[model samples]
Target: MKLGPIDWAIMATYFVFVLGIGFALRRYMKTTTDFFQSGRSIPAWVAGLAFISANLGAQEVMGMAASGAKYGIMTSHFYWIGAIPAMVFLAVFMMPFYYGSRARSVPEYLKLRFDEKTRGLNAITFALMTVLSSGISMYAMGLLLNLLLGWSFDVSIWLCALIVLLYITMGGLTSAIYNEVLQFFMIVFGFLPLVLLGLHDVGGWAGLKTGLEHVAVSNGFAAGAWSQSWAHMGSPTDNPMGVEWFGMAMGLGFVLSFGYWCTDFLTIQRAMASESMSAARRAPLIAAFPKMMFPFLVILPGMLAIVLHQRLGAGGFSLPTKADGTLNYDMTVPLMLSHYFPQGMLGVGITALIASFMAGMAGNVTAFNTVFTYDIYQAYIRKGAPDAHYLWVGRVATVAGISASVAAAYLATHFNNIMDMLQLVFAFVNAPLFATFLLGMFWKRTTGHAAFIGLISGTVGAAIHHGLTLPLGSVPGIKGGWLGLTHQYTSEMAQNFWTAIWAWSTCFVVTILVSLVTKARAEAELKGLVYSLTERLKSDAEAWWRRPAVLGVIVLALTLVLNIVFL
Candidate 1:
């Protein structure tokens, strides 16, 4: 179906206006802080919105939709189970340490708490991961646009990257955050309507329940482990594990939620941008509420699509498809939208998807800018440089980051699809880092050397698990030739997840064991590493914890209720 002239006009208008906002904010970014972190003056509400927006990548929409079509309400666990808990933990338990210590970045925190070598290693690893992850996010958007609208994937990616980069480069983090606030609302306004329309098309809740019952899995509630085979290989016919539903949910909740929400620079930068420590602590927790419910906007529609497709006797509704009659599960949501949604709703749905991509890309570029400016250039290249020089570096880096990301998006076309690529990236890069941050923050005895060892081992181990099946290292390059490796692996999300689990577990154990044999940082130096919630800091700590703690408890209670009620 052709996008109507009105639809095109609206999209064009939105794009132009956002670009204008970015340029308008350029004059305000006089210093590195302004360029990278909004000079630390963002209000809590704007920060919260940007926080939520940053997390809403194109893969997230597709993944949520894919799961929704396949898993029913259970798919909401991605956020409800994982993100909310992590967000609450960060706000109530972690933020005080980060904000109080005055660390500019997570790796900086490591250096202050551990050693400079550790910080440098982490900074490099993290930069590489961000590039890969951001590239994937950019790729997903382009892929979606190409598949849905028949646009050239390269052109789509370049256009998207250019817009995001333009704004991010001009206004810096301030522009990104402000635009993110608008993008968040745009995403909700655009997607939720489609979901509502989808339900309407499905004949409401009763029709939804009836459709769900007809599919393979009626209730994802029964307790057994995800099957090791399905979990390992990642079959569309089964849940990632086929493991006990509850255990898989909880385990994933523990791993992914904490990993992405706490450690990911995209989300952390939002909290870091707040005007004060109290605001930083609260902004993330506030964002958590929306995250827990985000599935309603994203994944739920996919589930509804599944129920409708099944009832219509549509085969491969949630499966991948080829030229011949086949299923491409990743296409489920888009196909359903095209088939079911009316013209107006379809327009809105498409806009929401684009909004999701924009918000995520904006967040990614901003975070990339911050890390580039603070960690790399300021820390090493130009130590004690004035803010103006650093700000210039950040803008330059934003362009470079966007260019690299667009190229990555072009390369992603070689991959299977968005969802598979996303999970694959997350497993290797994020899984180990999640373990590292947890150990680093809570365990004072975890040495810098242990962190370095753990991160390298986990990353290399996970890569081996996945890369062994492929020739990722065998590109005609000096590195590839030196390694003497051939691409053997075909990427699969399930394989990646299993690899990630092993990677995380390995890192956790190694870090612990290594710490046992290593010397701890001096207690005085490690003071910022651990939470010191003593009476001396009681007043400050209590004021900080009150609202966020209550919010956290409420979310926990809600998750328990959701488990009982929905899953």
Candidate 2:
């Protein structure tokens, strides 16, 4: 995993180009809107690439590989189950709401729709989540750098963070998108050959099937592995993966996708900046195809790596094990590349991996800047601040947010699993907001009082449920555990998952019930804010609907095909 001079050159060149792009575009980012929201001037293709790139971080690549190494094709559900559907739904149902309303931030929409308090609470919640989420993204990139190049984790974290900060501080989202487009192409071109080579190394498709089945039967993996039937996509306990089929699909496909694609600001920022509403709607759809192939590029290689690992004997590319004798799943991708990739190709893949980290950290920093500036600083401290001061504050916040996230990365250095931590964080933070936002969008009766109550109550409810599952003994049945929760508890992921669901349900139901008792906004007040679901866009925007029925049918067909193929 050592880097040669070539690797260093590539990395340096990448950073220099990124910074230059930011400086070159400095003139374009004149106003506060330009600095934070790209002046709403981004083209559809640019927005589309940035949308996908924001989600394609080092954690995602490594996490998918880890899942594949541990669980086989089952990991594909991360996109098939959740990401694809949520994005499609958003495009058809939600994009119109966001683009048509022309709100600067999503939380701003809450204020226009409901009341100021709703906007304030959302702003606070979203700002906090942005910081924490950015931290997790940074930590994952650092983890990747440490594993691939044998660098110190802290040094790697700082190195990645500083480079991203330089460009993002100068160019804002404009530079972020510009660099993302370049990285996206680099990643695809750089890593795809490895996948093709992997299939070759493992022999043909038939040989891969033979290798997979032989290991499945000989190692006493579940009978499902050898069965052509895809009924049980999840690995059994005896297999390397600890979860079942139902768990993987539902977790990745349903919960994670909805949270990341539908709600996360990092990805949404690009869509918000589209040149026109139609262009914005097309951005997410353009992203879906690439997203669907993520598992193919990232996950399948890891699974193949596992097959190669066992064939080479236990001594080859050995990973440090925990007391439970489990292979450190985080190391799966690195170990595989070290073992199987050709020496020359290994260097290319390593460089691409590093590019993945850069892309990820840059995206996080940009999103953090947007939320901190628009949602927190401008909204609260400087409601009437001049454009120049606001831009200065954005630059300052970019640096500050990056620094804070880097600190969080250092804190997360001790955690073993990035996906688990990410999922748990979203469970508490994302679930309630989804309900609140959806209610505000669709229901005319929902009041500011109801929205505030739902937002606070749902978040608090999640905290309580989170506490109960922890080993803190703070609640009688709970024990202290990971992330300052219950210790050594069973099914903590499942517990957190269901707790989040309950939180969302409670918030939605309570918000609705409360609205029933509260006063409603008058017709005049609500006129501009509300839109019918069937509202038609003008001709200019209608072109963005290029083949909606076609896209819907394709998505539904793919969904059913995956479910049937892997059922």
Candidate 3:
């Protein structure tokens, strides 16, 4: 993994351009709105790219490749089933409430639609989750840098923290979103070539498929592991994913996907920063185009890694392995870079990796600062504060959030895989959130107290389901919990899907029953916030193709074709 002076120079050049952008954008931070919401001035295309790039971190690039090597092309399910529909739903059905309600953040929507208690619950949980997620990104950056460049873990962590803090603190969310757009292009340019080169060396898709079937046989897996997606998903024991169609459809596709894509403030903040209602709605739809193609760019490289490893043997191309011979799946992307890329391209690959990491960390930090300063501090601790005072508070919160993230990064070192830990966190925090949002928006009869109770109960159900059903020693990285039942999960991925199901069910049932007993909010107060109460708005001014609903249908149809083709 040695780099030439040319590679070092290229890496240095990328850092200069990124930091320069941050410094250049500092003048834009003239008010709290500018710092937190970009003064609602970003165009649709830029916000759209930033929307997708917010999620295109090390977790996506490195983790998806790892899944490709382990589970084959079925890993595409995480993209197609797990992301696309929810993104489309957000754009077509839900964006009006989010963008039209004048809410500063998602939790603020809860305050307007439900009650302050529900908003408080979401705001606190979200603030904590964002910081912890930011820490995970920091830990990943340090881990990747240490593995690739031989830098110490602490040094890498501090370096990343410092860089994110400087840029985000200076220019706030606007700087972060702008940098995310730049990072998205860097990732596309850096990895598209790697996928093409790897595919060429492996003799194209057909050869790659044959290579995976051979690897599957050698590893005692089904022969179709490389090519099929849903054909082998009839039973939990039939495939490496250990998930059935029902769980995959209802739990992951409907619940988890909607929860993350629609409600998670990390990404919603990008769309909310758009200049107009139409742009806000169009952003996610625009992002869906590139989002659908990422599996080819990121996942194929991991499949290529397997082909290279089997052909070259351990002596020629080694993957990271534990003392017990288990693969450290997170190392897939780095290993591919070391095995296949040359000097200048290698530098670009490394920069892409670092850029993605920083974008992820910055997105979380920005979201956290806004949630803490506006949702928590201004709403409760310092009400009626001047705009300048809140703006200063946001800046101070940025530093504190990054500092907390560094601490969380140190805590994350004990985990085996960053992706597994992230999924676990999502199960605990995000699984039930969409249920709350779903009822709050569509069912005007849903009382505020019911929403609050259902949220707490749903989170509790997710925890209980994981404790009773998830088997001990099933996942490599996480320690098993108590309450072990006779029936155990086949894999962590299965546990994730089922947890969402149970949580969503609990939230839905509890909210409905309790809302029947409790008093509902007045219809006048719910106008524009609830579906039945909100007036229908036309998009005749925009062209047919530019309309969110039209774009959503096109995106969904294309996504369906990809799934069918892959199957």
lDDT of 1 by residue, 1-567 (tens): 568877787787778778999989988988777777788898877888888888777677788777666455656656776577788888877887777776888777777766777788777767766776778787777767887899987787877887887888888888888888888877788777667877787678776666666654444522211111112223332443233343344346676667777877778888888998767878887787787778778876776766665655543334445677644468766776676656666676677678778778777777777787788878888898777777778888998888877766666767645535454554566678778888887777788888888877887777665554432223423211223343332223333344567678878998899889998777777665675421123334455344667767887788667655554
Task: State every prediction's TM-score relative to the real structure.
Answer: 0.85, 0.87, 0.96
Steric clash count of candidate 3: 0
Off by over 4 Å in 3: 313-316, 414-426, 472-481
User: Candidate 2: lDDT of 193?
Assistant: 80
Clashes per candidate (backbone, < 3 Å): 31, 19, 0
Evaluated with lDDT, which candidate comes out highest?
3
Q: Model 2, 248: alpha-carbon shift in Å?
A: 6.4
Candidate order by TM-score, highest to lowest? 3, 2, 1
The positional error of residue 420 in candidate 2, measured at the CA in angstroms, is 8.9
Clashing pairs in 3: none
The CA lDDT at 28 in model 1 is 90
* Cα lDDT tens digits for candidate 2, 1-567: 565676566666766787799889888888878888888899978888889887887677778887676667756766777688888876666777777775777777777788878887767766656666677777776666665666787887787788788888778888899888888887787678867877787776666567666657666776446323245433434443444455445544455466567767778888888888777777887777787777778887776766665576632444447678866767766666666665655666676677777777777777767767776787777888778998898899889988888777776776635535554554566667777767776777779999899877887777676764552124433321323443322344445555656677778889999999999887566654555433565544344346444565576677678667655
Give me the runs in candidate 2 sitting further than 4 Å from their true place: 214-221, 225-230, 233-256, 313-320, 342-344, 413-426, 464-493, 527-534, 538-549
- Residue 61 CA displacement from its true place in model 1, Å: 0.7
lDDT: worst 10-residue window of model 2: 471-480
lDDT-better candidate, 1 vs 3: 3
Judge candidate 1 at residue 556 and give its lDDT: 79
lDDT of 1 at 467: 51
